[model samples]
Target: MTTTIIPNLQNFYNQSQQKQDNHFCDCTLQWRRGQLLVKPSGQVKQPYLPSLHNQPLLVECLKHSPVNLVSIDPKLGESSLRFWADACEQAHKPIFLRIPPGNKLPKQSSQSLRWLQRLIDWMIALVLLLIISPVMLILVMLIQSDSPESLFSCEWHVGQRGKLFRAIKFCTTKKYKLTPLGSWMCKYGVDNLPQLFNVLRGEMGLLGSRCWTLEDAVQLSLKEQRQLNNLPGITASWEVETQPKLLHLDSSTL
Candidate 1:
């Protein structure tokens, strides 16, 4: 029955209210000891919990949780919500006890446009791949002429919904050394050209949140991870474009 709360919850809640004009809402859970209580905020008293037989209530509860956008910690298994409840309790935030209406949720920016954009991106990628394949082959030969080994490199990346997929690119380095070519490719983003295949396959999009490796994703703050709820991974974003400036500033500050 130990309650651990996140001290930042109040600040986040207050900020949300100011930015959203009090439109920010979530399901409220109130529990003490072994008793579990659930309800939606801003609603009249109703028995939404203990009604596990009601599929709608369950869905509503999930839909309304403020932390829905945050990726669940795998180690928590199904008890993640319980942990959130404990955190809320420790923070001394008023425990809400009714599930919000399921239908009153905001739409994601990428889902509706995905299918239409997929075909267009695929056609563009196919054209690029055809044009680039020969050049890529030549580059591979050039690199191998210097040193013989694997021609391509694959790195696991995090995509939308926190899915992991392999991102492939031409090897720009020797076996042991990440070559100058690799660094150049990364600097100009030439290394990302092969990711067209991922876009064509619907594993990613032409424009959306930039994908990261699992380690990078895990390092992100809760607020940062919430951005992933909208779309699959992409080749670039504001974060990538401004990374250099950000790094410089961070270094100076440090």
Candidate 2:
């Protein structure tokens, strides 16, 4: 694979939360024969030759690789970004789309701190689940009686560092018609209760930026995309206080 040195966009998170000094985060990206390859910084480079076979090959060569994060060169085109974005999302790795020089890299916490935060998230979700078990059980029965559809609805949403995950919520509506019980549940935001499972799964937190669907995520401006650096929250200021007018309104609501 053709390898070249590029200025790494290291440890970027949302500005309001994290900060990191200038330091090389050991990561590598390779482009050869129209395919992308990611490797560790310390690995010895191997000679790459274009394959002679005519059969198609999967572009994701590192699907099982242990790379923690992947960074894309700012100069790469949209196709490359989309390919890596989907790949990284599947591998559950954060992706960094390098910004141009002179722009401040967003602040980020250390890896340990992030892990600590995740542990806390798990604890909080567990406690909440226990405390609300009775209410959730009653809601489940009501939802079953209200609609023939499944009890939960899940849709693809962008998570921290642009990773994509299915955000789960209670199925409050069927065919766009909110059930009588669903209307009451939504009015009190109880429809969001199922998302605590997403928190336990590490796909969301108790408080952070709103979770955006992939369609809306792709339409985001470069500056707005930075919000993906933070985990989507079960309850966030953006949902009620200061919403993004650009998002598809119907999709934002349960």
Candidate 3:
């Protein structure tokens, strides 16, 4: 496994909506894989995913991964700013005042808060999955009929707290080759629907940060790493914010 850091793009909910329930909505980090992909969005070499011989190996792999904490941007709100300052003072690691603070709870709140979040995510994922299943089936049949070799595929994405997970999505294209099936998948974003399962499994949220790829996350800075503290999401601030800018990042600077 390679050493990688999380990106810190923290910010908080608006000042008026301070309830713990609502704060997570904006604490989300920004992610944009299609935009930053070294190649057009398609099957990346399977080499990108970690190989594990056993369950313990998997746990050890994650344990070894450098942690990237989720943080709220100081520029976003006051509470976020205070929390970021506090963490900086306590950790005393870096001095990037040129400052932070999430879903990683303005620090880890009570069980009740956890329960509420789980329930909401579960309900929404269930509903969306149900509504999309038929269309999904049709799409799958079309994809398989069009190119039987590319019916299914898994994308390795960096999830909550920077753990790597395989997100299921349509194959879209044959290995190293683009087909008509791949074209539409990218055009309509239908390829992302399966992420709802990621949501139901508690690995992601519907409205959280843009899902991060391990390739992209590895390029993040200590300051940017704070972004991982929040739960990874399917739709995020990226939709509203400008495109993410990690394509040209130089890891040595960090």
Candidate 4:
């Protein structure tokens, strides 16, 4: 009996082999045939009364097997079975598939409120910064006591239309030789208050793509740079949302 396995299936098997013994059974087996063929010596038992869905067959097979996770790739062109498999896979259930059609592009919303909402958020942030400047001064003085260096760190950030400006914040790292208080403010994002000045000055907006450093901005692909065409740069998104995750994934891939 000859069976053909997808290259991804082989990779999954190799990855599974490196797992701990107690976790060794989490294998996703993918087959490209109409029906699954089990080895008589294989200890994993098939689930009784399995669904006919082919998309998630691998997942279902894994459930029935001693393993906690499994995936199957079956013969393509069977739409009904493929739909069931896709649904099962989405639910994190076991299923099989033969690589269905590519996903459709998502539609953009037509509501005109997005711009107005961004403007309102910017105004609120600006007002809050003005009301808090006095307190910020006091904090700056306190930071200066901890480190007798610069109380604020000025970082060059890229904003909308590829404009560059200095973004002021409290320093967080002792290695930077800035005021210790600046470092404290940076650690908690308290130093980001001054960026409200940038917002009011039209160099930034409240809810938009994050501003990048010149070095980082150059790394953006042409397609990614297009996202900047309509919006001002932001202070927080890259640090808070995107960079850490991307770095982790890149390291893992390497």
Each candidate structure's TM-score, on Cα atoms with residue i matched to residue i, is 0.50, 0.57, 0.52, 0.44
Instruction: After superposing candidate 3 on the true structure, give the runs of residues whose Cα lies further than 4 Å from its correct spot.
Output: 1-111, 237-254
Write one digit per residue (lDDT tens) for candidate 4, span 128-246: 88799799888767766776565666765555444345666655444433333443454455766767777777667776776665445545565565544444545454357244533
What is the full ranking by TM-score, best candidate first? 2, 3, 1, 4
Candidate 1's error at 114, in angstroms?
2.5
Q: Write the per-residue lDDT of candidate 3 for residues 2-110, one digit (tens) a residue.
A: 2112233244223234333333212322223311111111221112222112334434433444323223232333333333333333333121221123233443467
Query: Among these predicted structures, which one has the highest TM-score?
Result: 2
lDDT of 1 by residue, 139-187 (tens): 6776677546776777655555554456776665565555656555556
* Winner on TM-score (3 vs 4): 3
lDDT of 4 at 127: 83
Better of 2 and 3 by TM-score: 2
Q: How close is candidate 4 to the true structure, as a TM-score?
A: 0.44
| Candidate no. 3 TM-score | 0.52
Error of 1 at 241 (Å): 7.5
Preferred candidate (TM-score higher): 1 or 4? 1
Model 2, 1-254: lDDT tens digits are 46532225353333223222323222345654543444333444333211101112212434544455665543344444555566556555666544323235445666677688889989989999999999999888888888868899886666776665767778877776666676666656777788898899898998788887655666666777777777888887236522333122335454
What is candidate 2's local distance difference test score? 0.61
